[model samples]
Target: MAMTASTAGRRYSNATYRAMRRLKTVGLYAGVAAVLAYMLFPYYWAIVSSTKTGQALYQFTLLPALDFSNYWQLFNNPVFMGALVNSGVVALVSTAISLVIGILGAYALGRLHFPPGRMVLIAVLMISVFPQVVVLSGMFEVIGWLGLYNRPSGLIVSYLILTLPFTTWILTSFIRDLPKELEEAALVDGCSRLRILTHVLLPLMGPAIASTGLLSFILAWNEFLFALTFILTDENRTVPVAIGLLTGSSRYEYPFGQIMAASVTVTLPLLALVLVFQRKIVAGLTSGAVKG
Candidate 1:
């Protein structure tokens, strides 16, 4: 009888423990779902508002009305189209420049043995943290001196300040983590440093390059303060600045629907880029986290 009683007690304890564990798992999932909803709700609202027109924008409707007049109007706007082109040109050119420079700079910093190399890396990191607003006046003066003011070239040059440091730093970490044996083997086979970089390292750095380039593109694309301060012409403004300056038919009215539609439109490219390179970004980030 006592043995049977003990067996029943053990079974009851095991069942209680499993119940507790199940409850904890449920709570964890619930919390995660809540946090995801909180973070995503604003974007969802923007998408919904993009489909609304006029007074419908002011109303809090869970379901969108499927109206696309706002998108049609935005597409028809010359200013918006010009801004999109300017953004694409500036971002693509700046990302290309930064990646080329970053690859060479990171290679030297990672592979070469020299004095002040660490100091240079530290300086690059320090430069990245400086606020753009602090350097606005100086950058503006330089732009004017270079005769690039109000030009897309000026924005491309200014964006180097944003793209170069991070790209170089991230690439440096990736290069540092790479196996030195391959480079040494290339040297033994009479390959020069440039050849090694172009042949051996470049192919291996596909993920890192994609990650860095994507980040640089996004930075240049979404930049507003410099674009606003430097670009004097409507045709040269990027998407962010153009969206901010969007006007309604009447002076007293704000075109909320058009604004949301523009926002959604500009955001689509960024979202697609991120989604496509999500794995590469993750791999690049975590690759050098632990040293062998």
Candidate 2:
């Protein structure tokens, strides 16, 4: 009887412990689901809102059907088309400058040692933290002096404040991780520094360059303040600013569907980019995290 009682007690304890462990696992999954829902709800809301009709939208229905009427309307509008063009132009131009300037500057800083090289790297990183508003005063003055106000070039120049420092610093870290032996061997063969950089390091650092370019492009695409301040007309305004104007238009009472549709279009390119380079980006981010 005593032996049977002890065995029963042990079984009960083990069963209770397993039950508690299962409960804890379920709680953890519940917490994750809550957080994921919080973060994703806005995007889901936008997607649903884009499909809703004006009456159904105003009715505040919870579930809207997936329809392309709003998308069709957005594309039919000339203003929306113009905004897309302006955004493309600015993003392309700014990315081009950032890529060229960033690659060369980062390579020089990372590879060639000189006085205050570390200080320069720190300063470059700091530029990324400086608030965009702080530069407004200086940018406005420069624009005024150079007569670049309202020009596409002015927006491109302003975007450098957003792109360059991060680009330089990020690419510097990437370049530093490249094999030093490759460059040394090139030097042993009597190859010039510029040739080694152009012919050897450039080819190997392609993925890093692509990551930097993608980031710079995203920044340029989403920039609003500087574009809003400088670009007054339809021809020069980027998509974000133009979309803001679209929401204020008197045509059919600030169509939510149209605005959301345009937003989806604007965000699609970034979404595609993130999907394509997801692994590369994750690796780039964690590259030197555990350097020995």
lDDT of each: 0.94, 0.87
lDDT of 2 at 47: 88
lDDT of 2 by residue, 154-226 (tens): 9988898899998898999998998899999999999998899899998877777777888999999999999
Misplaced by over 4 Å in model 2 are 1-13, 247-252
Superposed on all Cα atoms, the candidates' RMSDs to the truth, in angstroms, are 1.3, 2.3
lDDT score of residue 177 within candidate 1: 90
Tens digit of per-residue lDDT, candidate 1, span 1-292: 9999999999999999999999999999999999999999999999999999867877998888899999999999999999999999999999999999999999999999899999999999998999999989999999999999999999999999999998999999999999999999999999999999999999989889988999899999999999999998898899999999999999998988899999999999999999999998888767877776
Stretch of 10 with least lDDT, candidate 2 = 246-255
Model 1 RMSD vs true structure: 1.3
Choose the strongest candidate by TM-score.
Answer: 1
Which ranges of candidate 1 are over 4 A from the true structure?
290-292
Query: How high a TM-score does candidate 2 get?
Result: 0.90
